[model samples]
Target: MKRRQLVRGALAAGLTTPALAALSGTRQSFAQALTRPVQAEVSELEAAAERFSYGYQGQAPTEVLAELVEYFDEKIPPLLDRPQSVTARMRLCRTAGQMAGMAAIVLGDLGERTEARGWFDIAARAAAESGDQQLHAWTLARKAMVPLNYRSPREAARLAEESRQIAGTTPTAASTLAAAVAARAYALSGHTDKARDALTDADRFMERISGEQRADTWLGHCEQKHHVHLSHALTALGETRRARESQDRALALSAPTSSMTRTLLLIDAAMCVHRDGDTEQACRQAAAALTNVSAHYRTGLTHTRAMELHRAIPAEHQAEPAARALRQLLAV
Candidate 1:
């Protein structure tokens, strides 16, 4: 339940905000269109996308997403104008959107904001074309994170609310995700009341989710991630006590191999502890969290949060080995 699952499933790559983005490439003409990809081809694409979805959470190399971006860009153009089953075309479009979204995240982490926004725009369009409200909603929700990361919480809240409206009363993971991100955005904007209400809505929506829905899409599989976002919103709203409690719950509920998420939650918890006046304890906790995580596992968002935690510490304590070590870890 790290940042990534807020839009798709699982934690988004390391310390960065877990929002989805899209890509832009030179427009391809429909003159080379094929009827549709064969079932085997579709299956292969699905398998690859799913594999990349899970791989994004751990130490999966950025190259993995890069390759997916290239693959989808080359493959999607030929299928755009082809006469095929509605189901098949939708599947293709959805896969392409997912790839574009993943690519956007990778590009953002690599410090390419303009390219990332282009990819995010493309993903949103593809999702809309697929007529998948869940996909469209989640993609927009991910785009909201860009504004939040850029310090435009008001805009982020607006976009998140828009995504929530698009998600409607679906009671699916996507709707829950939209609500959760809205909560975070509201908290960041200092609208504590709105944030709390959004959090309540998110919790209620998650309660209604029954069987698997949209399991084949990146926006699915986020049952436990709800708490992760809730924790972040709580933190931003100055509810340190509740924020720590929520982070503990998230860590306890998360899978063991989810080292990235564990690192994120630990960092959040450490901040809460620091807010409570246990400066040394907070420093120690943060240092320990960084120690356990591999360098390859850190995300831009996670690093952002870690830096915030470091700055929160007193200047005198900043020189302490624990604090210094945490800073060094993040610098890498």
Candidate 2:
């Protein structure tokens, strides 16, 4: 019974918040049309954008988000509007989609759901324009994060499935992530069989990816990230033992200065521990997950996880040593 409650509660943590600024690039000046330099510019900017996503937790996410906004609303449009070679236009459009996707992530991290949604719409449109099936699926799957965190798991799962279908026989890292998320979302919605099936699908997708396949970039996915997603899904299904295995692997690969991804993995592991009845240990892990990072970086997403962890503790243990330690941080 406790396990069932824990599963539901773990899957249920979410929030709704305001979005980002408007798209401002439509009026920006350009070098007239797409050229080799324009292509190179997109490439360089994308590299920086990838690095930006991996920023340390204490880093100012607001600054990077503003930068992405600049690119999306100002820098990239000129390149997109002017005529170029068929191949060049497609390449430029893919870059635009990538930038839009990255921007949406920043907005989401900032708790700006509305802004994220708009950016995702731009990315999906860009994907269509670029004629990249992978990008289209990636956009769909990536956009699932907004609803996965802020709305219902059922809706999130639906998006994940759509992404998988569009991904077809050749799944990219992003599509693989969509499958992993589908597992978690299905578990949250009490579809045990479906959850396991989605997890299998995720594993299959993971196997096909190679080191150079653009995994975990601004528009990529990686093994460590896959493990984190797996841990969350397994934890949501009350499979603590399996969840811990994946959690340890994810933590092992995570950088010390990791951002939301690491924190989320820690919280999920702690929640799994909490479900297994080790309230003290769970509290400590959960508390440390928040404490290791600067207070300003603890967005609503992490805050909600902390609160959920606290609530999961037995009422009797709420005042216990580790629980007390965790409780104190909650007010911070």
Candidate 3:
């Protein structure tokens, strides 16, 4: 289907118009017909999903991610029941699930939390049917994040534990991802000891996995970004000093291309500094971050985090020149 038709279908399927508009950054034209059989490799879908994962870092349009999900959705059914395609079909389903999960993440980043939840369900079901345990675990972890970020930490922690259970003893990248989120949920809920233990588990699992693993899952290797998340959890738990240290490590370790991640970590760092009683420094840090953000990332999750920094500023400090600049920057 063409992009316009896909948008119409999404609306017809009950998605709000505003939500569709928020996600529409991809190209409008699709050269290949949906039902046509092509010699596409499973790796292509994996790669696409990986690219989509980094979309937050590089400012990919929400619409582009929507198109990717649509492409994967159309391609899955045609390849499902071919007699000799059993193995290929399984791989296809797993890839489709990963694509769906990635799209859901994008939607969440765009602040369309309700729609993101539905896509997460779609991804989890597809992954489960494919019998890909790691993918299933990843999907559950992704689902847990919806609550972790916006709703109840108790639910998020429960789902994260379930994801870890599904992951079992396997020390794959997916398991580490689950552990990291579980840590965050625990921290958010004030279970400091549990949060610390899960943080340790995440680090241990990450170390055990040699080389890059699960490049196809689109969660990417859990290294610096994992630490960045750890810092976020630490900040939530009021460990500002430790959080600042972790944030420094994450920023130092991250690739220069990961500006989005850097900006996010910077925002977290600003929060830490503000909590540490350096509101001027926090405002300066946030103002610097605003300079690097692209329009695509300016509105959703980024905006939310910026608002957090704004809120962290003391009422007395709000009129400071740096704080005034931060307010102006985030107003856009």
Can you give the TM-score per candidate against the true fold? 0.79, 0.81, 0.79
Per-residue lDDT tens digits for candidate 1, residues 1-332, read 33323434312453334332311111122222342345557677767777766535554446666677778867678656566777887888887777777777666554456777788899989889888888788788878777765567898899898899899986987788788889999988889899999999988888887665524234564645776787888888879988877888888877776776677788888888888888778878877887777675576656666777888888888887777777787777
* Candidate 1 CA-lDDT value: 0.74
Q: What is the clash count for each candidate, in the order shown? A: 16, 7, 5
At residue 136, what lDDT does model 2 achieve?
Answer: 87
Off by over 4 Å in 3: 1-59, 81-84, 214-217, 319-321
Clashing pairs in 3: 23-62, 23-63, 24-63, 25-63, 26-64
Candidate 2: pairs in clash = 19-115, 24-73, 25-73, 25-74, 215-221, 216-220, 216-221
| TM-score result, candidate 2 | 0.81
lDDT, residue 113, candidate 3 = 81
Give the candidates in order of lDDT, highest first: 3, 2, 1
Residue 272 CA displacement from its true place in model 3, Å: 1.4
Evaluate candidate 1 by giving its C-alpha RMSD to the native, one decimal. 15.0
Model-by-model lDDT, in order? 0.74, 0.77, 0.78
In the range 192-292, model 3's lDDT, one tens digit per residue, is 99999998998888888756663422466556766777888899888988888889888988777566677889888888888888899989988888787
Q: What's model 2's lDDT at 57?
A: 43
Candidate 2 achieves a global lDDT of: 0.77
Scored against the true structure, residue 238 in model 1 reaches a CA lDDT of 76
- In model 1, the worst 10-residue window by lDDT is 20-29
